[model samples]
Target chain A: MDVLKGAVDFVQNKTKVEVNQRDIEKILSALNSTNHFWEVIFLSQKPFAVVRETINYLISIDFVKTDESGNLILTEKGKEFISANNIPVVKNYTCSCCEGRGIVFSEIKDAYEKFKEIVKTRPDAIVEYDQGYVTEETAYSRIALMIKKGDLVGKRLIVFGDDDLVSIAAALTKLPKEVIVLEIDKRLVDFINQAAKEHNLNLKAIEYDFRNKLPDDFVKSFDTFTIDPPETIEALDLCFTRTISSLKGAGCAGYFGLTNIEASLSKWYEFQKLLLNKFNAVITDIIENFNHYVNWNYLLPSLESSFAFVNVQPKLNWYTSSMYRIELVKDVDIKNEYINCELYIDKEAILYKEN
Target chain B: MDVLKGAVDFVQNKTKVEVNQRDIEKILSALNSTNHFWEVIFLSQKPFAVVRETINYLISIDFVKTDESGNLILTEKGKEFISANNIPVVKNYTCSCCEGRGIVFSEIKDAYEKFKEIVKTRPDAIVEYDQGYVTEETAYSRIALMIKKGDLVGKRLIVFGDDDLVSIAAALTKLPKEVIVLEIDKRLVDFINQAAKEHNLNLKAIEYDFRNKLPDDFVKSFDTFTIDPPETIEALDLCFTRTISSLKGAGCAGYFGLTNIEASLSKWYEFQKLLLNKFNAVITDIIENFNHYVNWNYLLPSLESSFAFVNVQPKLNWYTSSMYRIELVKDVDIKNEYINCELYIDKEAILYKEN
Candidate 1:
């Protein structure tokens, strides 16, 4: 038992200050009397890893013994060892808030509710068009909070493909002076225009297609843009480019919905690189599952052959998109345009290209 | 209101089949009765982004009007349009678990309690040596869960450093066939060795310095390894290389702790690339704030003069580390050795160097 001998000698001779403390005798008496070693272990705040091994070694050397119930009892050698050595006591560290997770959002519920009220009036998704609409409560909550946080209000906002109709939420706030939607769907554009006119809201909509160039009058006209583009890289890149094109200059903000269900981390990495390095944008916020779309049953019929899980038709609406906010960190080099970045990748493109 | 007229015309003719459904009449009646448009909106489950604007436009065109208290009251025109149009109702999508974050650990409490019990005997950190030990509960929880998940049981486990004494925790289970610790601290080595002998645990410890090569017998001999190295890239790289070398082969598991407090996402990206591509490992799990270290007051004295925030002595133990589990996906090439990686960047090291 040289290990125990060395530890005892170290405690007795090396830690003179601790050994001389008035609390040593009381601690020894407590340790000798306790049937449950865990109470003593807890009091000492020494980890289970260290204390268990120490106890096992001491017991092996006949310094301690276990009762019928497996509780530890100090033998004569243990009593003598305790009297000679200085025991270390450490406080238990506990945080009731996050249970040590560190990331605690205390007022998130209040905030979520508040935002939900603000976006309650937004549009319904057209299932026939592969439109997956998030619940209005979540939509309003996210958008309203962004406005409350001063991320959206007062900015000249643009909606790239306003299928989600976030422009209406922005307009209703009367926070932003102008809200415009560049929509591909004629019906939605017409519907939004009629709504804006009736409410006397500062919102307007114009028919636009991603396949075409940006209208000259709309280019670089907005201070912020919100988009819920298709997840394919080609479509995402194109919509992202259009959103960037619509921004007024550096310091502008852009919001977009991206889903992990369709876009993997590698895709996210590439997109982030494009936004950060190529476009000089800095991502400031990423809210996971900020948008959970209602059942997209129409898309399922088309996807069922490719995705067996779709046939299950579980009641759960599993599609969710994370909301991201990126702010321009440097002046936009308008000359470095990527508007023509492919909006569709051909199957032939899958083949590895020659260097 | 040409927009409203066109929308009505398009909705009536294009979606006649949906409009004729018997549910459409029930939805219209529900819409007409409720002052809360969100109810109809929810029934429509159409996202507020798309719906609100359409509603606002319809209201503007005198198709819907607000009652005395600002609640929507459908006009005769709105009633007429409702019968002729197919209204989209999107259902609210919510996850009872995780509030829609998608990752839920339901039995975390039970698992946590079990681990807490397992690690109750571990040692307190020796703060003088910059040993900011995590709570025994969390360490035990994580390690035990790993074992329960079959990541450690029946495997030869290696711990790069035994300051946390995870090797002891593993050995106590008698689950792992063998547990070895390579440590720089002599006291810990002696302490672990003694505990192993007394408990008849299959565990061993060898004192080793960071600057030296790992002993020949240990290399490529382990089925799993765990390490929590310093935050610096050089230290992390060196420690990671050593841990990788101790692994048996492909399909082996490894766990390590890294913190955002010191390592930025860019640094994480680089390290992930090295693991996924260079080492041919796949990251299986990442639990944030999985390790919460106690206050490292000893190192504060050295850092206090350099950092202004130290004077505050914040009550919260703000330091946290995320635990990562990686599994070998293929044979490790081991070509990119980091045995001599610079632990600290020297003045001369800043100069540009050609490979």
Candidate 2:
């Protein structure tokens, strides 16, 4: 595959768009956003020193043309290249009722409620104390929200940790091409697998540990991955690395749940830096209070004794985590850079950190 | 200033982080997103390659250290550099009820309603048949939505064309550092300037035509600009270039409204390519149906006699346009590239294009 193919297919006799490194970069940048052209030209090292060369390259390739006044126009070839490549353009739309504010997507709300009703009736699954489990509403919304974000359009998806059963909710949509859940808990693995089978969904649960290197077969094999990572910097890094490893390439996306309640602003700052520095990924969307955890009344006893939850259980579970969607902007291969960290953080320390 | 400073600052007797281009890029990249990083990265070209040299340069400068595991960690100097730079991070949290979905941002709704109530009382502004004015609700929401997006936050803003009075509504917030409206319509200029004075809002409207080069003082002087250019490719290109010309630099943003009714997907596709090819801008968001034009009952007589609207008044304002937020990702100077085009289009032909 020619890296500079500019999202064109070569037919036996068709002259392909003569795309160069900058042109390819330009096209990829265009796919990222119809408006982010300035950013693409300025942020990356190409096209500037070679401005004349790049412009000439585009014109020479018959992808673009300049009218008498030098206003750039896309040639039919250029337009065809863009249409054929189907470059993903960043969507500027939100729900009309919600203005993408999401409150008005009551249909989603209803679906979430139904999803929760079903989840409540399911057999009791082992609750991992360290991996905070969200209320069913939040879990269902997480799935619905991912769908809204266009992450599950018949694309292969990998859930790094699915104690939340997003996999089941996603399967309910029957949208993803494949759904694979990697979990350390045998109970969850069995439960999710059972649900997928019962629903006849394109989903599978695999027993996997984050501490081990990601399976070679899984590297760069999926379009998207979702995770609720341990809130510690070390654990967060591990989850990110694993998620990056599983992603197909640039433009591939990952969703993760993070809480300000446990992770302080500094932690957020550090983790954000890590994503950009290591993966060249940018956080595209951050939906706040997107995930509200179910009050894990049973886990109180397992908690660090000093945990103030040691007091009375609040009537309502107010714990909520923000959902983040990070998209890679360039071709980044960090499979070897995947770091291993304890999947479970010290609950007591995290609770204390919250305080 | 050294471009390789790596988000650090100079302190007397303080050891500077030995930062290479990559390290500096890593830090700058971090700063941009935590606050709109993609825009910063796209507008300027850096942090793309030159890896070995960049790394070696960093090591020689001593801004980072590599662990035996080969993990690159920031040194004290590097950390100091990042701290000193204090790059803005992207905000992830939105209103809880709205979930940043925007349903509950009622203050905007209220402001919009109030603006509409007031607008209705004003004498009918001369209806320019070529420039469609949206319904009062659509107009108010445009202003309110801009606020929701943090575009009006104490930043110098330019509205390239404001037949919609978005500048007046934006000024109503009393949040912007400054708001300037440039328009060819003398009626709009006088009306908006009067509104700003009456409201004691920091807004100014000047009678300026798009056909002329942007004022020299205004070049790269504003943080953001908004326009609703004519649907034709020629007009869209002119408005975009003028908007780019007015932007301060990378990380600045622009907003425009385009409709599927008048602009076909082909037009959309061509215009998008032009944005990337000419301006290097990236579209961050496109909120659909955000602008509903107030039906111009008066323009029926002036519209092409073939226009069916010539027969009967449509009760509903059927025209809706998507609002797009395009941010500069890199440093871009389009002062020279700004083009001029006829701002008006043949209504009948545009409607025919839609079919």
Candidate 3:
């Protein structure tokens, strides 16, 4: 069997994770598409650093070259190697109806339409709290999915942060017994409460910081909760533990979004371990690129390393997150504590700043 | 707050998993659609017994009734309760394009059409080894999904069994470097080898029972493996350990099918724990109802306790399973030895009998 030993050696040298000749085959097949670098990253689904360095190694070896548009194209040598090795260029053929999320919005079109109108007066996403909300359709899908999972009707649902305004969407359906939002942003809290009063819905938003401990009433009072957790480990710990503490007992469920752009696979391993082992929850669903976010105000000068090597303007809608649904198998008892976990300004930190 | 206290008590009494009122809310919400009993099982996604008994409790309370056609319909009391509780009838709005599986076979239609023709002479699914295979589209989807995940090309692959004939499908794509199938049924092994020889594909099949230890040549010789594991814990342990033993090392990948119909949430918990904790792997994706199976010859007398009350001829095409994708995070060391685990005769074991 033929082997690209040098490229394999380079990938191994650059990263500790073992990338064999087969792994290199994936990179070569991806480049065969001559897709944009951003699309390649989406295709490869590896850490940004690993993909970048592997591509660099391929370019140095002249197996891959870049066109004026900065897309990767396989050279003659690369094509020969791929043919010799029997590598095929894999394309994305996910369902176009729901954008491969498996959940659709047709059943809830009226509710989504009303939700689109309701969010017209919604508070804008501010960078102070690392805010970047999903499109109105995504927020609406969350409502439908929760109801489909039997998690919404007459269930006390809580939202950790309200930048997405999902709590308002949940209230619009009048499916849940109560919809509560605990927002660190006072502007969002006021705006949500104003909308609740106008629609006469059983939705309430409280102005509370994540760093502070929840009040006694808020602890152990919810049937379900949803949050787009902060990516850092410290922040994830504080937010997830707080959310777990809010659950009434076992058999409860929760939904959250995790992104590939920020968290590495190792980080994902840690996150899954935290949920399955430490908290006694089982992950039922993990749909990649399910949550589509509108480009935030902070994208112009994005974090340095995400696409720092590329000179072209980044593509939109690529900064998406996977939707995760987990159910508690056993009753959870967690300490509600204050955490001073602040966002550190790093290359992978997309939503946070020095503040 | 109005509580379905009696119903909750009945469900908690029936099961030790501690089903709460919110869990029952899911059952009530499911009945709001007045769907068939089989469809309710799909909608609620709880264990067959839990859903069945919960429905029994609802019927006793006059909240629900069955129509002449044996489909569930909400009575006046049930409708009143739902209206008062603000419960909405949740519908399955999964992407019709892919039948809610998030995968499409449009790109591989040619290969699938060819597979369709090839499988016309495929060996029949007999019950001795608990043999039932997925639909052609599902088998076809597996090939496409594996390629989409960059798991196929230039990778040495293995299939623990050949009842589904996915190995033949993979070989037809000419994507993998090598494909090996170890099936206990001699008829299947011969059939597969014949097809491989006819198609001139790099595929091999050996007749080997799962109870035997792997040969030296088969040990530690694969980049990827796929299996639809037995439902029992002992069988799962043996099959998974054997499959894991065959992996080349860490960074290797595996795919498997798990079902909510046969396996309860607790069983899924144990399965996930087995993979994530014991095997040192991380689950990357889990799409529910991804594997749609052709009704096996063993369905008329499918193990009791799964819809024993529903006297209607069992619904077609409800025996679906979820597709799970997991990757090794660390090098795995597992025992490869003869296992005495055999099929246990139980209500949950749909594929196995006292052979």
TM-scores, all candidates, are: 0.51, 0.48, 0.89
Model 2's CAPRI class is incorrect
lDDT of each residue in B1-355, candidate 2, tens digit only = 3735432332101222122233244334333332222222221212211222333445557765555534445578756765565422322222244333343335555566656755664435354536667666555556555554445655688987777888877777666779999988887788888887776878898888787888888888997788888776777878777888888765567888876555533345456656654676655555445566766645445534332212344444545666676666556666554454566653313322211
How well docked is model 2, in DockQ terms? 0.05
**Global CA lDDT of candidate 2, please?**
0.57
Q: List where candidate 3 sits over 4 angstroms from the true fold.
A: A1-27, A60-84, A118-128, A197-201, A300-308, A344-355, B1-23, B56-87, B302-308, B344-355
Superposition error at A18 for model 2 (Å): 33
- Between prediction 2 and prediction 3, the one with superior TM-score is 3
- List candidate 2 stretches off by more than 4 Å: A1-100, A103-105, A108-111, A117-164, A173-189, A198-355, B1-114, B121-129, B148-150, B197-200, B262-282, B298-318, B342-349, B352-355
DockQ of 3: 0.59
Return the lDDT, model 2, position A267: 47
Point out the higher-scoring one by DockQ: 1 or 2.
2
Task: Give the number of the best model, judged by lDDT.
Answer: 3
Give the C-alpha miss distance for residue B209 in model 1, angstroms: 4.9
lDDT tens per residue, model 3, B1-355: 3457787788667643346565577777778864677677666666555676688888888988776667777889888988887776867777778888777877777777778888998888887787789998889788878878877877899999889999999998887899999999999999999999998989999998888998778888998999987777777778878888888876678888887766766677887888777887778888888888887665556643333345445576767888888877777777777878674333445432222
| lDDT of every model, 2 decimals | 0.55, 0.57, 0.77
Candidate number with the higher DockQ (2 or 3): 3
lDDT of 3 at A167: 93
Task: Compute the lDDT of residue A189 as modeled in candidate 1.
Answer: 90
lDDT value, candidate 1, whole model: 0.55
Give the TM-score, chain B only, in order for the candidates. Answer: 0.61, 0.65, 0.88
lDDT of 3 by residue, A88-180 (tens): 776877878887888887766877888888888777766668788998878877777787787887789999998999998898887788999
Candidate 1: stretches off by over 4 Å: A1-130, A135-183, A186-229, A236-291, A304-310, A320-355, B1-111, B114-130, B136-183, B186-229, B239-260, B263-291, B304-309, B321-332, B336-338, B342-355
